[model samples]
Target: MKSESLWFIFINASLINNFVLAYFLGICPFLGVSAKMETATKMGGAVTFVMLISSMCAYGIHALLVAVNAPFLQLISYIVVIASTVQLVEMFIKKISPTLFRALGIFLPLITTNCAILGLALFQTNKGYGFIESFVYALGAGAGFTLALVLIAGLREQLEFAEVPNTVKGTALTLLIAGILSLTFMGFSGLGS
Candidate 1:
C-alpha cells in the first residue's frame, strides 16, 4: 500500500496529471511571472514552500473532515487554511529574508488566489492520499510547475532577442509557446500508465 501510493503520487504529480496542463490551475503565474528567469525561480521556490505546507495541513484537515463525515465543507476549509498559511509565510519571508521575499513578495499574494494550490489540497483529499503520499505529491507537483515556468521563462528570454512577429508579440506568442509545451508534456503521458 505504501509503495503503491508513493508511486502513484510521484507519477501523477510529475507527468500524467500535471497541475498546469491537466488541471489548468496555475495559469496565472505560469504566464504572468514567467517573464524573467530570476523572478520565475523565486516564484517557484515560494510556491513550492506553500505547496508542501498546504499539503500537510490539507491532509490533516481532511482526516478531520472524514471523521466527521462533512466532506462538503472541504473546499471552503482548504481555502481558508491555505490562505492564512500563505499570509503567515509571506510575513515571515519579508522579515527573515527580505531580498528573497521581495523577489517573491509580489507573487505571494497572487498565490492566495492561485487555483493550483487549492486544487492540490482538494485533489489530495478527494483521492484519499495518505500523509506521506500527499507530501510527495505536492513536492512533485511543485517541481513540475517550477519546471514548466522556468522553461517558459528561458524561452521568453531568448525570444526577447529574436524578431517576433507583430501579430504574435505579447500574449499570443506566449500562449502559443505554452500550447507547444503542453504538447511536449503530453509525450510523458505513457510513462506512468
Candidate 2:
C-alpha cells in the first residue's frame, strides 16, 4: 500500500477531521471530564494511550481477519481490544494516584465505551492505514481530543467568573460554547484538500 506522508496523516486526523469536533464521537468524556483542566489533561493522556494501543491491536487483528476471511468480527474484536486497554489504564491510575482515580470516577471505565476509541480503530481500517499510519492516526486523534478538552475546560473555568443572565446560564451556555468551538474547528476542513 502506498502510504501518505506522516505529517499529512497527523495534521488531518488531529485538526481537520477531529474525532470530537468533526466526527462528534466521544462526546461523553469530552463534556464530562472536561470540567477541570487537571482532569481533562489526565483523561487526554489516558485516551491517547488507549488509542495508540488499540490502533496497533486493530491493525494486526484486521490483517488476521482479512487473511482468514472472518471480517465479520471486526467490530467485536475492536471493542474487546479497547475495553481491555481501558481496564489496564484504570488499574494503573488506581494504583498510582487514588485521588485522580476518584476524580476520574466512572469516566475512566466509560472510556471502554467511548466511541472515539472504537472510532479510531474503525477509521484506521476504513482508511486502509498501514501499521505506522495507524499509529500516527491514533496519536493525532488523541491529541485532537486533548486539544478540544483543554480548550473547553479553560473556557468553562473562565465562565465561572463571568456574570451572565440566569436564562442563558449552565448547560445552555456550555452547549453554545461547544457549538462555537465545533464551528471553529470546521475551518480546518480545507487543510486536507
Candidate 3:
C-alpha cells in the first residue's frame, strides 16, 4: 500500500506478479485465445484495454462508494466497469477488423469476465494506489498479459509441426509448455527486490 516507484510497480505487475503466468488469474483466455498468434495478440490488447479502463473506473467508483459510506457496492461496481469497457472494445473490433474479430470469437467477448482485470481493479483499490499508480499498474499488467499470450502463441505455432507422440498432443502439450513458461517467468521475481 505504501508508495512504490512507477517502474517498480510496472515490473512487479508485468513480471514478478504476472496476472497470468505468475498468479494464473486469466487462464480461460490464456489457453483459448493463445492457439493462434493473431487472435492471441488481439485478445491481449482487448484484455489490456479493458483492464486499464476498469482500473481507472474502479478507482473512481471506490472513492465514490467510500464517500457515500457504501463500500459494499464495490464488487458490483467494478463488474459494471469491466463489462462496459468490454462492450466498447467489442464494438470497436467489430468495425475495425472483422477477421480479427471473428478469430477471437467468444473469447473476445469473454474479456468482460476475465478475472485478471477484476483482480487488477481489486488489487489497486486494496493497495490504495493513486490514479497514476493505478494506471501504471494496469499498463504493466496488460503488457505482461500480452507478452505471455504472444510467447505461448508463438511456441504453440512452432510445436504444431513438431511431430510429437499422441499422448502429448493437444492440451497436454500446452499445459506442459505453460508450466515451463510459468517457471521462466518466476526468474523475474527478484527483479526489483
Candidate 4:
C-alpha cells in the first residue's frame, strides 16, 4: 500500500503536476536565472541536488515531529533543516569541485530561498509521505524542475538570435516565453489522471 502511494507521489511530482508549470513554485529562478543556457543548466542541476537532500532531511524531521507529537513545528523545522543542508552541500561542492562551485556558487545559496524547495518539504509533510515516498517525490520534483529550466534556457538561447522587440528585450521576453511554456505544460494536466 505504502509502496503504491510512493509511486503515485513520484509520478505526480514529476510529470502529472510539476513544481514550476503546475504549482507555479520557483518562478523567480525560472525567469531570473534562465537567461544563459549554460548557467541555467548548472542552476537546474544544483537545484535538483538540493531538492533531493532537502526532501530527505525534511522527511526525517517529519518523522521526528510525529514521534514528538509536535507536528506544528513541521514548517519551521523543515525550513531550518533545508537551509542548513543547502549550506553544507554548498561547502562540500566548493571543496570537492572548484569548477562546479564557481559555476553554481551564486545559485547554490539562492536555493535556500527558493520557494519550491521549501514548498516540496512542506507538501511532503502535509501529504504524510514516508521515507521512500518522500525521497522519490523529491527526485521526481527535482527532475521536473530541471526539465523546465533546461527547456526554457534552450528557448531563451535561441531567442537571443531572433529579433525580439525592444519593449520585451530582457525580462519581458523571458516572462512571455515562460507564460507560453506554462501553457504548453497545461497539456500535461491530464497525464496521470
Compared with the true structure, the alpha-carbon lDDT of candidate 3 equals 0.90
TM-score of every prediction relative to native: 0.92, 0.96, 0.97, 0.90
Q: What are the clashing pairs of model 1?
A: none
Q: Which regions of candidate 1 deviate over 4 angstroms?
A: 1-5
Model 3: colliding residue pairs: none
lDDT: the better of candidates 3 and 4: 3
**Which 10 successive residues of model 4 have the least lDDT summed?**
1-10
Clash pairs, model 4 backbone: none
lDDT comparing candidate 1 with the true structure: 0.86
Candidate 4 runs further than 4 Å off: 1-7
Residues 91-178, model 2: lDDT tens digits: 9999999999999999999999999989889988998999989999999999999999999999999998999999998778878899
Which ranking of candidates, highest lDDT first?
Answer: 2, 3, 1, 4
Displacement of residue 67 (Cα, Å) in model 4 is 2.1
Report the lDDT tens digits of candidate 1 across residue range 118-141: 988987777777888889999989
lDDT of 4 by residue, 10-126 (tens): 778877788998898888888777877887777787788888888898888877888999978988888898888888888888888888788665677878889999999888778
Cα shift from native, residue 103, model 4 (Å): 3.6
Choose 3 or 4, whichever is better by TM-score. 3
For candidate 3, the TM-score is 0.97
Clashes of each: 0, 0, 0, 0
